[model samples]
Target: MISLANSAARRSLRTVSQVRTLSSGIDIDVDHYSSGWNIDDIGEFTAKTGKYQIKTFNKISEKGLARFNPEKFEIMGSDWDSTNANAILLRSHKLQESEIDVSVRAIARCGAGTNNVPVARCSELGIPVFNTPGANANAVKELVLCGMLLGSRRIVDGVNHMKDLGAQGLAKERVEKDKSMFGGQEIKGKTLAVIGLGHIGASTARDAAALGMDIVGYDPGLSIDSALKLPNEIDLTDSIASAVANADYISINIPYIKGENGTHGIIGKNVISSFKPNAVLLNFARGELVDSEAMKEFLDNGDGRYVSDFPDDLLWDHKNAVILPHLGASTEEAEDAAAAMAADTISDYLQTGTIVNSVNFPAVSLPARPDGAIRMSVINKNQPGVLASITDVFAKAKLNIVQQINQSRGDVAYNVLDIDPTANHEAISMKDLQKELTMTDGVLSSRVVFGTPGCGYARNIDGQYWV
Candidate 1:
């Protein structure tokens, strides 16, 4: 029977084995094992078997679409109905729960947030949803800087005034006289409170620090690595109220989750009431994160400024508000990087069952499939004895496990098992093995992958409820 140790112990064993394999110089591709299989090899394998259909929404960058090997992937745009697609890639398109087809194994959003995708529903269906977190950090960071300037200075109003003057044919005469009317305070020496402290938040804080701004940050979920990367000048605060209490500017960089305890209206009356009277609030994250009614009251009651990329009906014509069309990640560089990351993420998950940057599933990865061995991926409910039941199936079939790894997140558990069929006492049918595995109690899905001599690699079996 296969040993079902804890996930941490299994990961440690896998690490030691990898180190030993590296020292032995066994001609194994360690990079491919750690990262993923080469696109060319996947293309070659799919060319002989069948291609994976990728249904794309919105205008995905051509640079990103190129990452998928044309021979192995069929890209379907808006013009085509791709209900049989193996995966979905999109940006800004609000994906409905009903729109997710049964054939889809994964969903990828080109940008950082998965709000546009039906993440909870996808999770229940055993579908992993991916998002590029730091892919557009630089773009959003630069835009946040612009938002700060717009909030502190009268740049937007000044430009509009100039257009009005030019239309009246008094541009040169009124330029000098009207300059003082658009005067505002400099951002230098100002205090900036950054909420969330994720990729975009950290980047914005770093750049703002370079501009001589005092940074105060608040994030309860901050990781050790992320905290270590923060600037030494930043003051860590315990709560949102304390962080923005005395700050000159406040930046909201958190995500928008919809639930009772979620961040849907994180910036409500209590949080807004604690803000400094003349403080400028910047939000490039999500509109739903802030309470619209509370924010409107805050703006109307004081001289504070509200600058955001997301537009709101109530705040659209507010004198203290500066709204811009959502352009946080609209740069060419950001779009290309996001698309490439999304494409590569989808390819790795679909071809090798290696998931990294997944928003809905736990991070799970395994080494390259050894020669003469087949790899099996199983998704099941996280419960006691689930692993035992899985291994019992292999034991009954007389299959020998070469290596295995398992990980869990919340209600879901994922297992990757490498079995050596040659070492089995009796021959087993691949189809029957998969069917039995899928029929196991609590099992959500199962997939089998093996390499062919002439072909690179192929998935011969898949058992999901939708399938």
Candidate 2:
């Protein structure tokens, strides 16, 4: 079972402001961030969706809430109604199986992991999930340094040992006599194996190199941007086994992709057996990435230690386990950046049908359509002729296609169409058109909207709920 922090239960749906005009308004529900981010920018951009309303929870950042233009949109208190909420902006609050709302067209998480949000269920519901991937890179990188230091040196043990002395009579003498027991090697000149050279991994390698630690890294999924961010001195490893075998310390920075062929127990028997006898293993990633049974067996047989932010029952209270509360992305700056990014991405999706950092859908962003043009967004099963069938409905309605784009992610596909009836504007009825599009086989959800160029929000009132 996956367990989150105690703060996860504080489920809050925050910020929404409604416009007084008769135009269709999008209701954006804001929630509490761990450190409370500045999302006034989100409110401002979302206002482009003609008349819009923002509903915020009591825990919303005061500075962010104040950014909303009070003259344009109605701001309500915590008792505000959210039945019409178009989206959810959140941080750590978990959206479990039965809690997923049908009205929410999308969910934008302030941080990287979507574990708190049921991503698979969102995909099934055809609701996009957005996350700020590198927004907390620096915060996690610094924490990696902290974990490495704690693992290599007996700093925590030393501090605990000193605290036990209590400055009693002759305490200084007692401390001086027992200091050697807490002694461990310094990090300088030690080899550090960094698995998953993504944002956090690359940053950690660069900083660790500056501190004189030799860096060995491996990441099959490393992007070009991440590769450019790495220090030139790092030795690129051919495999995890090779990297772990050669390092004095190992840092696992990969995300947990559940059920991937080699994911579950990625740091299993082979890697654990090859570790330097007294080496330190750090897992700031996910708990399921490491095989707890193998880790327990390894630690029981040697002087090695394991440091992890996500600890299961096997690692809890173990002599060599240095378990930490998941504090990698807990810094104030990280929280603010993540929340701001998440808000911006979500606003972009709602106003323009452009998805940038969506976890469930492939990234797609199109140029703004001309004024008075209608737009259609369809989420359907990934299969042949799904696009043609959607376009056929538009063609039969005698709509001129201004621009169209289609993208697929795994088993689902998202299509966007910009239509202009030109002289036949009276012939195209949006209400009837949406009905026809939704009736198409393989179509999960469809929305038809018209207004200013970036003023239309996709309203999915008939979204399928997956429990």
Candidate 3:
């Protein structure tokens, strides 16, 4: 709950490259060189920690930079270098293979859509990437309403047509005469089909319902909690075809992850063919969710109007398209909320071995250890004997387990353990323990965190503490 707005001007945002290795431990890379906006909550969280180092490029926001006290945390200003960055606090900037250093342990994006992040590659590297899902739900919901309004009224085209009318004598008369040509229908009585009922999708459905729009949603993976939270009037449809076929407008809110039964082009030929003629399609989600070429064909056929938050080369400036610069989660409040959540999530994981919102690994939050205890978090391939190997290593080292929690998702499993590190117990080398786990058959990554909730250093013991 630390506020950075009070002292934003004290820290200037400029392009510079520098490196400062504090403890060769947890060095965080703050995306300052991307010319993207930063949030103060992340800096405030880091500042309060007083344990880690944060490296920044030019993109670091004034408030975010201002909150960093040298005495509390090490802050490095750099020009686009992430070589020594172990953890990354990122926003819109893309995290490609070249930009990622082997030192990176985790990457936390400030917003929900992780399309800007290379999630699959990170998973392969056994690095858990995180996102703030519902933190910006309100922001995206408001924008979806805007999109609905824009589609129903044809405001984008109408405004352009109005601007084209020169300010000559009798221009007002001409506008009045031509106004009816741009007139469109209202959304109150219309049906809106929402796909992928995640946080933003469900929020959009509820808000649109309050505006008198009938909601029809389709999401095979919708959780029971999310389902219960949805408005009662919303009719949950069984299939995408059913949702898209009967609606006057459709919103694609699903993630664009490509895998086994993947959503690479979920809104392609089948969904488009079944849509009601003149149905408006709103996609505030990833651009890849809908196939650009297929969507353009549908738009060119004059069957429906397409509005996208993410515009690609194929659909840019199309007469039937209203393209936005990915503003779904761009509000000031959303930026702060998401950044704060991401910072807090990463801080919790690094300091206390807690995984809350990781995309690759299962969420595991264990109770805080006592005064003197050693904590460890392990991410390994989900297979037999992995946990046994981990515990056996601890047993061999004579480390007493104080408390532990374990969870698994698909192919990966997450383990958090707090051990008694008293002088009377055997002196266990965290490095040797990590090496043992890494050498095990299915083990992917292992980390040992020293200290408790208020202070700790998460280090990879396979090699140097930083790596």
Candidate 4:
């Protein structure tokens, strides 16, 4: 009878282990830093896709998408809307490989540059960087034109007056400023100067033309052929000043950068002072592209009507200037597109490591683990015996190690360990493991995660739904 009971107990344990392994599909990383989306959206693609174990924030040490099964899973980009996504990928991560297959749709953060994301990092890591550059070009370009027209026409004044407490203030001012400012100048048939012919600039020029505004494009990067599609009466100038000098309204579409020579003040104080008296200035680009103080002084004291969407102190606190909290691509269409595109990228990376928009690492397509064990990503000192220390903790816990991957960062080591525990133990119970890791002389930080395939990221969309 005792022998029979032992046999039954062994079978039960095996069944539990099998269920745990069978339940292994993909582990999506959940955190506040990520936009809400997960691998569950790509269920039809991976039929053999394992059980998805929900991973916690502190469990994974690799930031952004690196925590997603770093070993077997290769994160990369692809034409998500076109491809059969049998893999998972992530957005907002640096891809580390080259000559990779990808499905990527990337739109910049409304006039943002590939500037902050270095190409060398992607090239060295063997990853390809492709962007959906013109994806939302029309939408943003239209907004820029609208901003310019409004700046020229002072439409913000109308919007502001409705919010004001003074009765009849708007009615009184509308009749007064319309004929008063610039002797009643309208945006129609006026010059619209654009500083960049990149995606947004391209859009701005095209749309501004429709509104009967003459376009003046000044970009050192754009060729004459590309500039030809601009307004028929538009002017193309080599100098930045040539664009600003003859404009009834100015739009700075340059990417934002910090530092003295970092294009922070491309529209310098000197350039601003040279503007036509009462010339309208609008910046729908990065905040650092223009000189905030000079612009404030120019608008507040000079003869100009300033309207912008940037969050500069001068723009927000001043009356003439209109400030928006970086809502260029905040439209429902843009948000939905971004969310879907980012999701597809993350899902692809999770399954195949095909990193399309990654800043580092090559794009790859592979599983995180073969045996379907819990994936733990650790970022720590790369010194000798660090791996031994981590493995020993699992050894002490009497867990079975299935696979381990360690990527070195200079002197630090990022380790991904897949393990089978002896019993049901919450990975967070590894506080002792965390303490032991922090206590290690060389260990920087330790984390654990469930490996799905792509970037593991999450947020409470409906809020309180996770409960």
Best by TM-score: 1
- lDDT per residue for candidate 3 within 1-467, as digits (tens), equals 11224334312322222222223232322112111113333233222232354544325344443443434445554453323444677777876666655445677887776877878777766778898889888988899899988887768877777676764454577877888877788999899999989898888898888989999999999998789778899999899999888899999888877788888988898878898889999988888888888888988887478888986899888877888998887777787777678767766676667888898788886787765565677777788988998898877767678888889887778888876645323334454565565566667666656521222222232332221
List the lowest-lDDT window of 10 residues for candidate 1.
Answer: 29-38
Q: How close to the true structure is residue 122 of candidate 2, measured as C-alpha lDDT?
A: 80
Ranking by lDDT: 1, 2, 3, 4
Q: Cα lDDT of all candidates, in order?
A: 0.77, 0.70, 0.69, 0.51
Give the TM-score (vs. native) of candidate 2: 0.81
Per-candidate count of clashing residue pairs (backbone under 3 Å): 0, 13, 11, 68
- Model 4 root mean square deviation, Cα atoms: 15.0
At residue 204, give the lDDT of candidate 3.
Answer: 89
Model 3, position 124: C-alpha lDDT score: 64
User: Could you tell me the lDDT of residue 85 within candidate 4?
Assistant: 25
Worst 10 residues of 3 by lDDT: 28-37
The parts of candidate 2 lying over 4 Å away from their true place are: 1-81, 167-170, 260-262, 425-427, 452-467
List, residue by residue over 190-222, the lDDT tens digit for candidate 1.
999999898989989999999999999999999
Question: TM-score: which is higher, 1 or 4?
Answer: 1
